[model samples]
Target: MNTRSPWTVVICAAAVVTLAMGVRQSFGLFLPQMGPALDIGRSDFGLALAIQNLMLGLAQPFVGAIADKHGAGRVTLAGALLYVAGLVGAAYATDAMGIHLTLGFMVGLAMTGVTFTVMLGAVGRVVPPERRTMAFGIVTAGGSVGQFLVVPGAQLLLGQLGYHMAFIALAGLIGLAAVLAIGVAGKPRALDADGPAQSVGEALREASGVRSFWLLNAGFFVCGFHIAFIATHFPAYLADKQIPPAIGATALALVGLFNIFGSYAFGLSGDRYPKHYLLAGLYAARGLVFVLFLALPLTNVTALAFAAAMGFLWLGTVPLTNGLVSQIFGVRHLSMLGGIVFLSHQVGSFFGAWAAGYMFDLMGSYDAAWIASIALAAMAALVHLPIRDAPLVRRPLAA
Candidate 1:
């Protein structure tokens, strides 16, 4: 395997992220049925996930820093252990607090280790610079493959076995991810050819001075909100519309399926076109799609169609977004900067997950959540426009 093609790293890296996320995606499958089964409300469920995203956001920059200094393997292994522990804990969770601590905090910590912000940044190092967009896209596309492959199995297993068993199985799957992650051991790229290392504080000051950094941060917030709200609430909303939970699984799978294409396409486009404009159009289109879905019928057919449409727009942003960061900043501190931006995304996720639940708890529906997501999408589209994607000069910091 060490003698294998460089794409092998990309494949393993993406697969690792995919498998990790695939297992986590199943958590939503548990929500529609699990809440009632456990005598919890949507608020409780949402808060748990909100905490997870919060932890994920909080941990990302730190994880990114470590990946910057050491390598991704240690982070991935650590994350895999946390992931397995979280799922195991969640499987037997008897109270809302347990869910919050285990599923939320534990999973969040683990995911920070495994997610693409760190992994793909690592991939960015070895891959040729010209093909970076396509490479990032292809690696990210593997995550889509996980989403598609895992959600249905989760839904089906939930149907045939039960939620508890599903969690155990998912936990086992995460253990397998740890084994795969061991293969990720290798030499990491230097922070730069010139610099000894890029400190997080130094990275922050540099990234903060740049307009594109904040734009990327702000824009990523919407991606978090969009993903968290839908991933958490879609099934419940579908069930409200009288659709079977299975339909919810199918819709999610469609999102995964279409995302495979969307992510790669957008990644390719990012390489060929100006990335910010592409990002702007993507967010804008997402808003329109949300408007159409909310304004029209709520059938399984429509929901599945919406899922497919949305999926295409799904993580496709990741490659372009990550690409832009690496491009403007240089790949030296790519993981750290990307993680900081991803923190904004997770912050949005925290609100999206919790707010969607809180809104539903207050208003008796997800209409408010959908409307809010639309507005956020519009704002995100505007945020990226002023970003300067060109590289900034690295001046000596004040001693």
Candidate 2:
């Protein structure tokens, strides 16, 4: 079977990821406006997002397996349609239940098909082993690009056209992504020269028995918690401190901006360094950054600085984690295995988004959430140290 050029596939995968992730990242901007208009409490809105995360996690493995067998393009196209439908539904949603069905369930499920796991799996399969991490980094960076560009545009739309119309405009962008998904078509027929082909059942059985697989899942959980809490609540957190809404938008944008660099740098580093060590260091640094952000006085400058610092670290885990998976297991079932790992991340995301809002409503502060994030980061750092990152030596399948 013929395949597209590797670079062509990478670019297309990146574009698909850009739209899916960019749109997902901008949801935080809707919170302040959405709550008052829908008569939903912050916790209710947070629950919607929490449900979205859970659904995304729950759907990923199935979607990943489908992508593994069929192709990413079909799944992505389907996801784009669902995304548009969800946005339209969200636009006219009159109550929390409506919001939960549309924004929470539908969009979350769509994300499984459109976001990193499927696209990065496609990229991982096509690229050479040595270049795989950097390719994953580039695709992951594409999401950061979306964050950098889409969040501010979303804020602008929110300011002028209102939340409902903004959803329509974002839906249009997702429709465009459906076109890009065409280029990401085709599943890899065999593993690259480094390994022999393995059946999906064999891959799953192998991964399930490995301790490092679970460790990677545990470490990624912290990443999900960190990103989701910040993405969903940071803007509102800034607003609560009497910071202007525009600054919050700028801060999120900066994160996207810096993340572009962070993901790439880490991807490059993953090729050269021990990825688990890099991951351990990344988590440790996050804890340090959070401590400084809390200790410093609350101000626009400090907030933006924290955003830049956190953004630099944001999504860096994706490339390294993905690369490590490919390193340990081959790319034969990268999408499926990656989805399993990402499911854990999304579980953390569910808590991070929901728990923060729950605590804020009950205690009137996000202090507990921030403290939890710091602690989780520390734990993630420790977990990565014990991970065995060497490639698995599988015996050849019997004829």
lDDT of each: 0.85, 0.93
Per-candidate TM equals 0.96, 0.98
lDDT of 2 by residue, 133-233 (tens): 99999999999999999999999999999999999999999998889987888755654324666677877899999999999999999999999999999
Q: Model 1: per-residue lDDT, tens digit, 1-399?
A: 123355777887888888987776667778866788889999999999999999999989888888877877788889999999999899899989999999999999889988888787678777766788888998888888989999898888788888888898888877877886765655574522123356668767878888788889899999999999988889888988899878888888888889999999998999898899999999999999999998887787789889999999989889999989888877877888888989999999999999999999999988889889899989989998887877667666567
> What's model 1's overall lDDT?
0.85
Where's the lowest-lDDT run of ten residues in candidate 1? Answer: 189-198
Evaluated at residue 81, the lDDT of candidate 1 is 90
TM-score of 1: 0.96
Over 4 Å off, model 1: 1-5, 191-197, 395-399
Angstrom error at residue 253, model 2: 0.4
What local lDDT does model 1 show for residue 202?
75
- List per-candidate RMSD values in Å: 2.2, 1.1
